[model samples]
Target chain A: MDIVIYGTVNSIVFALIAVGFTLVYGVSRIPNFAHGSIYVLVGFLTWSFVNDLRMNYALAILLSLTIAAVVGFIMYRFILIRLRGMATSEIIASFAVSLVILEGLRMQGIGGFKGFIGPFYVLRPFIEGKMNIWGVFVDFQRLIIIGGGIAVVGLLWLFTHHTKMGLSLRAIAQDERAAMMLGVNSDRTAMISLSIGSALAGLAAVIILPLGSVTAEAGYKVLIYALAVSIIGGLGSWAGAVLASFVIGFAMKISTAMFGAVWESVVLVGTIILILLFKPSGLLGKQKELEERV
Target chain B: MSMLEVSSLMVFYENALAINNVDLRCQKGEITGVFGANSAGKSTLMYTISGIILDIEKKERMRGGERVTVLGSIYYEGADIIFMETSDRAKKGIILCPERRRIFPESSVLENLKIGGILATRAQAKKTLDYVFTMFSPLKGLKKREGGFLSGGEQQMLAIGRALMAQPKLLLLDEPLLGLSPMMEEILVRAIEDINETTGITILISEQYARPILPIIHHGYVLENGVSVLEGTSQELMDNPDVKSAYFGI
Candidate 1:
């Protein structure tokens, strides 16, 4: 009962972290390395607004997410647009942006601004209480993560499947030239994708950061967790990302419960290696099938 | 005035001329065919006119792959569109049904058509959707199937149907009858003639094997080694000894 409840919560958390990363990759073919930095930035920004500026908590969240989205738009328009097609440069450039944002947050004593360094920054949960489910004690924050995860996925599906804007994005994702031939602008779609992706990262941070304190160090960890889920699931495969999240979530939780907490990272890395050795494409990754067929 | 006019068009990929000094025109509400074998620049001419070559040139330049150069003026609806972006050109109703049927493989047939309708108004999209269904009746039954799974003929139909959803004013069909059975080719040729007759959309079609589309074209140009070697009405092209021996398999 404990494994089932905690495992599900853990999987939803992974989904929340990686969905943004996967979405950006899916649409723009950009592995947004700054995803984690944006997540952490939102957390710290929200904390600063609420604690330092004495703003209302809900208002702070809205501001932080908006800033995060704007950051994404600027990142694509100014910096990344010049280096669009070259994959290695994209990775290096985005990772450089990630380093600047993450390290800049940890900078000390600049212009009377103390850096966001320690575990003092934490977001208050929407509701504070514990609920018993099948003899397992799960907090309201975890419940919120589950609900948020389902909502995000469902809304995204509807957006891509039903709406005109979303259909344009998907058209660009599937075949860029074909989409352009049909009048869908690739650059515009890619720009929209980056903004939506960053907003999603901000949303995840606001929901998940409430469970524990927000720290600059958590940025790197969140990035690695997101990478792990994407790699195990297959890069750019949304359904694969969700399934791989459950796999890693259960593996980590079961290992921590039985063997010890030390085995958690070991299991995560081991699973990635095993999947790479056997099925390198990830379980549900079919990105290249269409190309080969054509 | 012609609906589309290309004059002195020359395209070079790293000084290897793909299209050289080719001038063509598509009169409004007439089917214009450019017939050539492979490497005769049929696709390049189509790409140049639709402004897809600009995109290809940009991608090649970005990747440091090939240096593509285009020197020409493409006048569409009385405006010089030589430097216009492909999507902008598409918005102006210069839609291309690309060679080999580049449908969105993962999307359902209906979704592919809907994506093609991104630039269309709701009423326009609705009317065109019904028109596409009626014209390509096979697509109506395969609405939910993914495009990649369709057979070659069905894929070609979907590609043409998908292009029609964009409400093209000057439809460019690049080798529309490539790799299909005789029956399928006959159906598409009839469909192309029907579309041109009923909708009055000016069509610019390119084909290597000219026998199938020759009967439907109002005027035709024969290309050889990146140059427009001969041009006349369909009757003249059919009567030309060189064309009959080379393209008509006489």
Candidate 2:
């Protein structure tokens, strides 16, 4: 009972972190290596605005998310655009940006005198309490994480289905040249994708950071978690990412329960390797059947 | 005035000329057909007119793969539009229905239509969708079917309908009859006529098989080895001995 409850919560948290990466990769075929940095950056920015500046919490969240989205837009416009078709260069450039931001936040005096490092960078949760679910005592933050994660996924589906901009993004993801023929500009679509992806990261950070103290190093950990889930589910498939999150979440939790806490990372790496070996396309990668038929 | 005019247009892929100095014109509210055998630059000509060649050129340049060069100009509605972006050109109502029926394989038929209708107003989309369903009733039954699962003929119908959803003034159909049955070809040819006659959208069709297309097109250009060797009215091409032996297969 405890395993199921905790596992579901862990899975939702993973989905939140990975949804941004999945979205960007799906639309533009860019891995968005700066995703984690944007997450941590927004986390610290929201923290500073709420704590140091003593601004309204909701307003600070809105401002920080907007800034994160703009940063993503700038990243694409300035850096990623040059290396658009080169896969290796895209990975390198985005990773460099991530490293710069993460390390910069580690230094003293940007958001605080001591910077965004150490245990001092904790964020207060929206609500501080506990609730019993399935005979397991879980905090309100975990509940919010689960609820918010599902909401985000559902809203994303509706956006892609009903809205013109979102449909254009979907079209670009499917066939860029074909979409362009129908008046969908790939560059503009990619720009919007980056902004939405970054904003999603900011949203994930805001919700998830409250459960633990925010740290610069957490960026790498978040990136790995996002990659792991995306790979396990299948890169660029939304449903795949969510399902893989649940699978890995439970696998990691069950391993921890049986073996020890040290086995968490071991399970993550092991599951990734196993999935790659068996299903190289990550269970839903582009559906090769279509190519085979052609 | 012509809806689209291309004069002395040449495209080279890394020194290999794909389209050797070609001049083509599609008058307003007419179906202009460009017929050729494979490798005759029919697709290249359509791409160049629809501005897809620019995208190809950019991609090739970025990848350091092929060097694509385009010379001369294309005029649409009396304005020089040789270098317009493909999407901007599409916004100006020049939509390409693309080769291979490049439908989104994972997306459903309805979703594919919705995606193609991105540039249209809500009312235009609604009206076009109804018209598409009325014309291609097979699509209505396959609304929930994934695009890849559809047969070649059904995919072609969907491709044409999807293009129509964009409300194009000039519709470029590239090899729409490829890999389809004779019956399916007849249905599509009839639909093409209906679209041009009813909606009055100008069409530029490129095909290797000129049998069905020649009778329907008002004006036709026969391309051989990247060059326009013979061009005249449909009846003139039918009477031309060279076109008769090569394309008519008569």
Which candidate achieves the best lDDT against the true structure? 2
Against the reference, the lDDT scores of all candidates come to: 0.92, 0.92
- Clash number for candidate 1: 0
Question: In candidate 2, what fraction of native interface contacts survive?
Answer: 0.92
Which residue pairs clash within candidate 1? Answer: none
lDDT of 1 at A292: 43
Q: Indicate which candidate wins on DockQ.
A: 2
How close to the true structure is residue B245 of candidate 2, measured as C-alpha lDDT? 91
Query: Runs in model 1 with CA error above 4 Å?
Result: A289-294
Model 2 lDDT, residue A245, Cα: 92
Residue A276 error, candidate 1, Å:
1.6
State the displacement of the C-alpha of residue A151, model 1, in Å, after optimal TM-score superposition: 0.4
| DockQ of all candidate complexes | 0.87, 0.91
Give residue A249's error in model 1 in angstroms.
Answer: 1.2
| Local accuracy of candidate 1 as per-residue lDDT tens digits, B113-209 | 9998998999999999999899999999999999989999999999998999999999999999999999999999999999999999999999998
